[model samples]
Target: MLLNGRNAVVYGGGGSIGGAAARAFAREGARVFLAGRHPEPLQAVAEQIRSAGGLAETALLDALNQQAVNEHADDVASSAGSLDISLNVIQHGDVQGTPMSAMYLEDYLRPVSTAVQTTFITAQAAARHMMEQKSGVILAFGGSGTQEPGQYLGGLITAFEAIEAMRRQLAVELGPYGIRVVTLRSGGIPESLPSDMEGREEIAGAIQAATMLKRAATLEDVGNAAAFAASDMAASITAATINISAGALIDW
Candidate 1:
């Protein structure tokens, strides 16, 4: 009941990670609003939450659309009386596995541009309402990727580092207003991989071997971390990035 009666908004709520967070928020007594481009998956997740006696609603939201995102935040605040938590897990269209040397210019720019745009749009929209309330949590995924030992990530790393930078700035600006901005970074969750993906087992094994725990973080782990961060228990945590990578990527 850490988030009892809280109003949480989750972007990309239909996806594995998003759905996990949304369910965790609801389980902790938050009324979750699931938003994404597609309604079928959104509805499916909502139904699951509802079946488990958790409050959930679905919305067709395009996080990249500034106007739509703003209106959605306004509506949620107005209807629920507050916007307690906001998390963005939308796909950044990152074309990974491609070497930068042979990668097209568009492929590299796609993730970088879209990640910054959607993140700013959703965070800004929620911050407006959160400022008025004088307290709220803005959660972001894909924490700082700059420290990761790799050159294979290409533009994906650039996007993650950019978001971490933005999270810091927002935390500084919103801190006085009692608003918290946090980022959750995972070294890569094994269960989050698509079932049809090729070499899935090999990739998952590599991820586990790289982690200090000898296991990749699970989708449930991300959800639990998110719920804790969004709750009052983590009130002292802000302007910080939480490492849920199971020591795969050291934070300091």
Candidate 2:
């Protein structure tokens, strides 16, 4: 019951990571508002949470739509009495597995722009409400790259670094209002891969072997980590990136 009586807004709540985190938030007592571009998948996650005896709701909207984001956030706050947690997990449409030298400029820059815009829009909407209440938690996700910058990640690493920088600045600005901004970094999760994806086994193996734990992080691990970070248990953790990569990111 870490989030009892709290309200959480999760953007991209229809996807694997977002759905998992939404369920975890509801399980721990937060009323979760799942917002994303697709209603079908969002409702699916909402059904799962409701079936588990938890409260959940869904809102279909593009994360890139600033006005829609602001309206939905306002509705949530007005209805629920507070906006306690905000997690932006939208897919940045990144094209990875390609070397930067040969990548298209659009491909290399898409994620950087999208990730920053969506994160800022959603976080700012939540921060406004959080500031009024004098407390809140803002969560973000990033690739965090390899130990020494290996190959094939393309603009994904840059996007993550940009997000990390934004998280630090947000923490500094929101600290006086009792709001915490944190980013979770992981090497990669095998469970999040599409079922019919090519080289699934090989990719999973590589990620597992790369990690010190000899296993890739799971959707459940990400969800649980998010719950902890959003809870008061991690009150002192802010303006920082929490490494859940199992040693995949050496500096962690």
lDDT of each prediction vs. the true structure? 0.92, 0.91
- For lDDT, the strongest prediction is 1
lDDT per residue for candidate 2 within 1-252, as digits (tens), equals 999999999999999999999999999999999999888999999999999999999998899999999999999999999999999999999887778898999999999999999989999999999999999999999745653345477778889888888998899999999999998888888898888977788778888889887877899999999999999999899988778888777782
Error of 1 at 171 (Å): 0.4
Candidate 2 — which residues are off by over 4 angstroms?
147-150
Alpha-carbon deviation at 204 in model 1, angstroms:
0.8
- Window of ten residues with lowest summed lDDT in model 1: 145-154
Error of 2 at 178 (Å): 0.3
Model 1 pairs whose backbones collide: none
RMSD of each: 1.4, 1.3
What TM value does model 1 have? 0.97
In model 1, where do residues sit more than 4 Å from their true spots? 146-151
lDDT of 1: 0.92
The residue-by-residue lDDT of candidate 1 on 1-252, one tens digit each, is 999999999999999999999999999999999999999999999999999999998899899999999999999999999999999999888876668898999999888999999999999999999999999999999986543344366688889888989999999999999999999999889898889987788778888888888878998999999999999999999999889989888866
